[model samples]
Target: MTFQGSLPADRAQSYEEQRASPRFALLLRAAKLVGAEGEYLCIVRDVSETGVRLRLFHSLAAERRLALESAAGERLGIEKVWENGGEAGFRFDVSIDVQRFIAEAGPYPKRPIRVGVEDVARITVSGETTVARLRDLSRQGAGIDIDRHLAIGQHLRIEADALPEFEATVCWRRHPSYGLVFRQLMSLEELAVRAFRMQPGRLR
Candidate 1:
């Protein structure tokens, strides 16, 4: 279940001896660890094809199996293998293309570069579809205004013009405003180019 600190001395030595892949240091990209307790923001410290190391703000007792959503739009099932203070390491359920992900550079941070937009988007949850007003957009997620109450962590699909229809999970909510993290994050450069190409009249 939960790892409080570094691996035991004997195990640490064994772990070091068994390494098969080289790990690449990360650049403080944002990520999320979803466990039974809830979702917690984390910074990726390094990555390899088979595993990742993360820097967490606080300690959490998470289940052995958890979902890691990276800013680069990677959703990985990971098992905690080691921990030390604010740092932890996890092995992926399936090996990934480490170089491909590392090159993408993840999504943009929330708020700072979000483009204000007025677009009608459809939110589908459990076969029910509701129209929501897209208030602002970012590569990682979108802020939408909707009348219906949505529970945090509810899985849904969003469809809108100028944006690819994608699956997302409700991450934050405040009355009519809800923030959804996309299951597949768009490239920051792609989003910026699209926003810039939109005609002035198209912006709401």
Candidate 2:
């Protein structure tokens, strides 16, 4: 059968294309399986049963096998789907355990919060730091505009007065702007309260 510009809705299968799924907040680490490449810590904005988008401060090899480790230090195997200078995507070897994640993110704000990039501070994987404005903030994660294009799995520290400094990874980059998945999200309620109150907004 010939396909048109978009696939037929009824004909669509249960499984969606890897690139089409929405992103989420994920916490994981990457360890190089071969060569002298060192292990890189990473994070995800969101993930699917099959794949994930990650951020690495250091360079990662394409077509190389990597060990994806959980916050508890559990490990899994994954293959690089794509990689640019400082960001990449990988397909997980097996479906991940979805229950481990708990929602600590606040509800979306009614209006876009206008904050400078410097309001949300960032610490590089190498310990370098900068103050950035928060373009957007959510209970799960926040988007900050920074000059660096962090690698998909690289680890770094983030700090804001509203919330304690925490670690996270780069999920993707749109040039000077990039997505961050909070590496350490302990309580969604706390995150939500802080994010909402920081700007002018009511709790949802």
Best by lDDT: 1
**Candidate 2 residue-wise lDDT, 125-188, digit = tens:** 6867876666655445667787766777667877777768877877777767776777665443
lDDT of 2 at 98: 43
Off by over 4 Å in 2: 1-118, 200-204
* Per-candidate TM-score against the hidden true structure: 0.48, 0.38
Task: Give each prediction's root-mean-square deviation over alpha carbons.
Answer: 14.2, 16.9
Q: State residue 73's C-alpha deviation in candidate 1, in Å.
A: 2.6
- Shift in Å, residue 203, candidate 1: 43
